[model samples]
Target: VLRDERCTNLSSLIFATIFFGNLAFRAYYSRKM
Candidate 1:
C-alpha cells in the first residue's frame, strides 16, 4: 500500500512539472511572437 502511494505521488509530481513546463513554454513563445 505504501509503495502504491509512493508511485501515485511520484506520478503526480511528474505530471504537474510537465504541465507547468508546457504552460511556461507556451507563454514564452507567445511573448516572442
Candidate 2:
C-alpha cells in the first residue's frame, strides 16, 4: 500500500513537470516565431 502511494505521487510529479515544460516550450516557440 505504501509503495503504491509513493509511485502515484512520483508519477504525478513527473506529469506536472512535463505539462509545465510543454507549456513553457510552446510560449517560447511562439514568441520566437
Candidate 3:
C-alpha cells in the first residue's frame, strides 16, 4: 500500500511537470510569433 501511494505521487508529479512545461512552451511560442 505504501509503495503504491509513492508511485502514484511520483507519476502525478511527473505529469504535472510535463503539463506545465507544455503550456509554457506554447505561451512562449505564441509570444515569439
RMSD for each of the candidates: 0.5, 0.6, 0.4
Return the clash pairs for model 2, or none. none
Q: Model 1, range 1-33, lDDT digits (tens) per residue?
A: 999999999999999999999999999999999
Of 1 and 3, which scores higher on TM-score?
Answer: 3
In order of appearance, the predictions have TM-scores of: 0.90, 0.87, 0.92
Pairs of colliding residues, candidate 1: none
* Deviation (Å) of 23 in candidate 2: 0.2
Model 1 weakest lDDT span, ten residues long: 1-10
| lDDT at residue 24 of model 3 (Cα atoms) | 100
* Candidate 1 overall lDDT versus native: 1.00
Clashes of each: 0, 0, 0
Q: In model 1, which regions exceed 4 Å deviation?
A: none
Q: Where does the lowest 10-residue lDDT sum fall in candidate 2?
A: 4-13
Q: lDDT by residue for model 3 over 1-33, one digit each (tens)?
A: 999999999999999999999999999999999
Q: What is the lDDT of residue 18 in candidate 2?
A: 100
Mind sharing the TM-score for model 2? 0.87
